[model samples]
Target: MTTWHCLSVKPEELRLDTTLNCGQSFRWVNTGDNQWTSVLSGRIITLRQTDDDILYRTPDDNVGHVEEVLRDYFQLDVDLGELYKQWRTDANFEKKAGRFMGIRILRQDPVENLFTFICTSNNNIQRITTMVNKLCQHYGTEIGTIYEVSKPFYTFPTVARLAHEDVENELRQLGFGYRAKYISQTARYIMEHHDETWLRGLRNLPYEECREELLKLAGVGPKVADCVCLMSMDKPGAIPVDTHVWQIAKRDYKLSGLASKTLTQKNYLVIGDRFRTIFGTHAGWAHSVLFTADLRQFEHRLISSEETKSNVVLEGTKREVSQARRPKKTAGVTVFDRYPRRKRQILEGKHGIVEKK
Candidate 1:
């Protein structure tokens, strides 16, 4: 095993639990004992955290500059603590972000981030994660596995591999559904017209221009483009408004004049612009904290201290408290049932579906 190294970061500044699983990047696998393992930039890396540090290691010493790779991937140069302090100035942000800290955005590979988010159309995080893993398993190069995980990890596929004629059928067989064609066509488009270098170069472009470039690709709508822009392209101001954000805007901020039922394109721009007005340049990052807080999976964290104490019972001299389980239903609706019902339309002669708002 490679020797473990430390990257100093406070718990309040970075929490792997929230950052890894909060519907951002979906490649990380939690391998018990607080360790997360994944194939990043063609290498297998494992990470664990303490209250004051992030501990990382690889399978062997051959993986040079592990620290550099991690620093870049995690965007450690940015001070999340300072950003938190600024975001807390807003009452709504302060309320929702109380239980959520250390939720920094991961600067992922553009190719992986783009294609992974293409799978996110009208989909949930769990399903998106499965599709990304299946894509890697089918087309990516095999990287050696860690002992903690039984299955071998693989590098994300190159554009050439995913652009192959058989990729769409293979992805459909692996259960990608309509997203299969999007992935294949986008891959082929990039390989034929633009390359990975060209895609990554968008990071240097202005935010709006970068988004425009991404919108020209197959299956990349306004939301997906914003997602790619924020997560991969150097666009911290890019806020990708989805159902959760739309609700948060109307319910929390009390922004009026919103469409009563659906999130229209006009409403989408309105929400993103509103968040930018509230949270400043890094509105996307701040929006993520609130978005994570609203997720049903994280609802248990919002329980007040008094609520936890109330759940406790005195049994003679021994005090026992029941563990908190994730709620099966929220407000009379099943968790998945609450997802927005999107209407998928087939654009004539296009390989992808247009999701009507």
Candidate 2:
């Protein structure tokens, strides 16, 4: 039987259905009765919210400080109330806040965010979720299972694991399509030429520099890099403009030239800067909420019916790529496979951290 640890939280502060499945992180699966389960940072964790608190569960007995883990992962420290207040200053934000209230950006592992967003290129949420799950099932260590799906849960695969495995062809066979090569090459480059330190170090750099460095990887581009920046790294100002957001820029913000269709590199920057001007330092979070609401409202009208949300797509950015075959195996641990200790200081940023009494 799975053991659960409970953490008290205000009901008004968050809604699990909106936050978890809003198309940010893909691992968590909704089992039933509002409960969600996933293998995060190598441990199989499950959670659900009641009227007064959030309940977290895990099959592993040694999982320490579950409350702290939830705090960090959900970023409960960041004040959504204050953010909503700030965002409501804009008329459009005020109108949409009620419908999408309580949506929060997850603080996911940077490595996972990088690959996940890379897989996001020209893809939809369902396929992206499937690809990520496949990476975990094929290469990640098995953790446990949830009732919603028959397959046992597995941790997200690490760079070393994907780098060493015959991942490209395997991923192609698994229906990753063209993204299989991008995932394979990105993993190989990380394992061969860099380390986790290099990737995490990008966090400390300026957003522009970090985006540039990330673009050097096989399939990473402006949208993917900015996603890793805003979602994982501490830069909340990073606005990842995709087709949905682009339509928003035109329809809502009335940013001209976007109506002709397609996100050019120039228009991408213009839209991003316009959002920063409107939402201030935390434009990325604002973008997330707006995009979430936009996506929910405009589900059928999206560029591709399969398209979910997140990141940008430059019209002239696609380039030809050499095909990668399966490579020989080696032994090592991946960053995603190893769970690290939680940080003591949560980023309170605009609002002070609040704990349930």
Candidate 3:
């Protein structure tokens, strides 16, 4: 049965333009009906909300299946409204945060979300987005050419298709850099180990257990795994604890005073343990909600640090080389106070994969 209900609104101020430049596309656009559409799922899906409920639709007639998947996967009925309200009231909630620039994190596919977080390590959002788009156009199934909406945005590559050894080399051709290897390894692991049936186990496992499993993949640190867990698996306390959040905890929460020494993962946990006490089971999601709220303040703090400048730590050369050509909007480069955002959107799908003939 096709049912339409109020799921959520795509906040206009935070809506992004997904057509032109996915790398630098983080601004909001008005859909003209006091609503906006987000090109999520590697540009395979778009979501908009009406006055009451959010409408989830694919580019095809598979809306029933897709809606069921979202309902079951996200557990949308589990006091989410109350949880959102609590998040809004928390002392740490940043004033403009509850909408999170209308990112619509809940709407993204779980598998893609997990894999995308893996690309986030030691990178920036622009570069990360570009890389993700590139992977899709090169590897994923084609939906159709919709000249009306987008010229075309491909679905994300399946784990089965990306498990090829050549994926590393192919992605490297797209400027994925070190993450090319990580993506290959992650693809290989999921393809070899995660059968279709295993997807069910993802829901049964405890959030910690699932996160630990994700961490086992190459290039997936605790922070990346935590982000995947919290955003996709409903791990309410699975705070990803990136550089910006780290600073907020220290400066605002005073969980730890600024120390002269280099901070370590254990140092992260010391403060995180405190959040566990304060935000409790919802701390993980709470951290995200607050992080979204205070993004301007957090961005101000992180962008002010010096290490945001690109410093390449060669895997084997053991040589530190200065970056050659840097992107213009490198605002997230200066994060010395925290672990630092690995700033960059994923590579675009067209790079190195689809060549102009």
Candidate 4:
């Protein structure tokens, strides 16, 4: 076991539970006990959080500069608390974002971010995660397994590896669907015409120029290009307005007088510009907090006062009643029982109510 080192960050400033799984980067696995494990760069890292610190460890002691890596990956230098204060000035943001603190934009590798998001076009988080894992397992360099979990992790594949002739067919076989061609063509284009440095060099360009360059890639549309721009290429103002965001704009922001109901190319740009206007320079970062609030999987986090009282009752019951004899149904249906099994587990875990089995 490696020595666990502490990174001092308030839970309000950075919540691992919310930020890691909030549809930004898809590789993190919730391995129970509030610890998330994933392969970042080439290192297998495990992280757990406390009230005032984030504890991180690697498989061994030789992983030099792990702290720096964590700081960069989590973008810890940016003051999220200050941003939250600023965003709260907007009534909509203040209303929705009360529980959704500590959400930060990850500074991902441009290469990895580009290809992984290529797989994300019109895809859900679960499927996108599966495709990205498959890509890494097949082509990426084998990083070692986690200590007790025994599951091996791999680095995101290099451009050369993903650029091979057989990669597209292999990806299709691995259930990449139509995204196989995009990944293959994008990889080959980069490998042939540009190097990883050139791709990363876009970080130095203005947001529009950076986005324009990304749009030249095979799989990159406006949304994908903007995703890369904001997430990887250091453009915090670039908002990728998908259907969810379009609804957010129309419903919450009351954006109207548009020509079409559908999110046209023109409307997409309009919505992004509107958000940038509302949230200022780090509008994309502010957009992520609201976006996470709207996700179904995270609805359990938004606990109400009534629910909290119910949870208190449930806790009291759990203590008074024996584990085996405890009533499965509290009142009509217990709070935990209302959610799906997976979300129930998450809620139960959060409330410190252990499952019977």
Candidate 5:
């Protein structure tokens, strides 16, 4: 393993577990130890945190200048200490921020972020992770392997790679369901009418302009566009209000506008504006921290409820229900592992392994 050290980062400034695994970016996988393996811009690297520093390893030495690459990917230049201080002036943010101190919004590739958030519609994190990884495995070039599991990592496919007609149909067969079409159509649209730099150029535009441009793509709605803006495009004020964020807004802020249980577009805007007003410049970052806290609490309550009812009968029934709801297996291939008719593409094959060329 080739290793490098990041001595500038502090434990409280960046927590790898919360930052990586918190449903923002999907390519990262936990290696069961403190390490995480992920593919970024076609380079595969494993990252782990010590008490005082963050460390990373990659197999390819010529990938070049690992320190700057990781620093940019993790957005480590952002002063989390200063942002936390700004957020703590408010009681609600103060409470939420304390629980997730080291979380920072990642600086991801814009087109990748666009397609990833499109898959996030009406989906949970587990399913989203599955879909994104499947997209990479099927369409993206294999980069390298996780040392621990020997599981190969793949890059996020370029827009050109995903723009083909067969990609849509194949993705549907691979269990992407409706999201397959969105991703496929969006890829085709960009490839025909625009260049890859089109999405990246939004960094210079205002948040509203960025959102407007993003919405022109297939399947990108306000939330998805706003997500791309906030997380990847440097629009820190942009808040993507999903159900969890909506609930947090109504419950904590007691917003008078939120009367309905469902979040309409109008309500979504209201919630976004409210948070923007409350959290000021870095509202999206603060909003994400709060949303993470709320999500964790909800998950904790769910697990506690399940454990409280874990009598033999309840446990058996839960297992039965879970199995019943799971997608049926076909010819020893479970639904999640299903692929298209085409042979899996391998970019570089050596030692019976595929790595990026």
Candidate 6:
């Protein structure tokens, strides 16, 4: 017999730290009310309006235990009281700066994580989720049961499974942009190196050395590597600086002088090193909290600007700030619903594959 427990919190019980994994939403199967089960993690996680924190069982067939491994990984045993006190009193820390964005670190499988973060470079949450879902349906195992929905879905594919498959063209057909190539390359790389576990051994090496190992991978750039380091490898404060982070650090943190003419590979190391010095060991975690909050603020402002609002307008020359700030749209768009379209030459005959032109 095995014992399992889930120390759950409504909002607080769940630490919204993206350090567990990158911010890819492991969508919950709405098994009735508020309870959520990650088929990947195989844990039924939930929050409550009650006094005690929530609890969940570790996924069955797991090598050991998922939640227990997670607890130690997150250092849930440590008391944050002293740290919170330090944060509160430090004026330079900027306590009243913004609301903390609630992010849950999803317990994704190791291989899924490798490929998922690889796809995350120069991408957004919505697009990443769509791509992951598409990959799962195309390559992953058919579990043969729809828990929450009327239709069916499946788990993510293993590296061994998807390596030889040409999933990229399919992704292109589905509008994945250039990410199709990255996914294809990463899968192939994994397939080529079946016994490669050298990455996991980099834990004790110097930060630069560890980061370099990550860079050796096809799609693992600075940000993606940093995300993997922090989330997958238990590195506390590996700040993954992207375009949004570059903007926020300059505009909000007054780090404009720190800005470089290029976002080159070297610059990523320099900038990340500087922040680690500034924020101490947990700087990476701090970056996560602050970055999320800052992004939410930007999102809110954009939304508010789009919505109806009434304010006094200046007389002669003043234009609405929102109007001036709006993004430019692509010109000249057309749609042909029932029009005669270009046709592919079909030779539907014996031993039929599409014939080479």
Give the local distance difference test score of model 1: 0.79
lDDT of 3 by residue, 1-357 (tens): 222222342222123222111222321233323234334433333334321224444445344455555444334545544555555555655453432423323434556776676677678766677777777778876666432245465667777777888999988889988888988888788778775345335756898689778779888887877766766676667666767777777777776454625457887777667777776787765565556544553333223234544444421212122232232232221212122433222122111111111
After superposition on all C-alphas, the RMSD of every candidate to the true structure, in Å, is 14.0, 14.5, 15.1, 8.9, 12.7, 17.3
Better of 5 and 6 by lDDT: 5
Per-residue lDDT tens digits for candidate 1, residues 148-174, read 668999999888899999999988888
Q: After superposition, how far is residue 79 of candidate 2 from its true place, in Å?
A: 1.0
Q: Which is the better candidate, 2 or 5, if ranked by TM-score?
A: 5
Query: What TM-score against the true fold does each predicted structure earn?
Result: 0.85, 0.80, 0.66, 0.85, 0.81, 0.66
lDDT, model 6, position 20: 26
State each model's CA lDDT, in order.
Answer: 0.79, 0.73, 0.53, 0.79, 0.74, 0.52
lDDT of 6 by residue, 93-156 (tens): 4443222322333333456667778767677777777777777778776554433345454667
Per-residue CA lDDT of model 4 for 176-206, tens digit only, reads 9899999999999988898767889999999
lDDT of 5 by residue, 1-357 (tens): 343433356656887877887778987887644567887767877676543345566766444766688888778888988888888888988755644667888989997899899999989888999999888889888877754677788888889988988998999999989999999899999989997788899899998988999999889998898899988999989999888888888888999979887889999989988888888988998888887777753344223243233332321121111232222322221111122332222111111222211
lDDT of 3 at 130: 71
Clashing pairs in 4: none
- TM-score attained by model 6: 0.66
Among residues 3 or more apart in sequence or in different chains, the pairs in candidate 6 whose N, CA or C atoms overlap within 3 Å are: 6-55, 6-56, 8-54, 9-13, 237-284
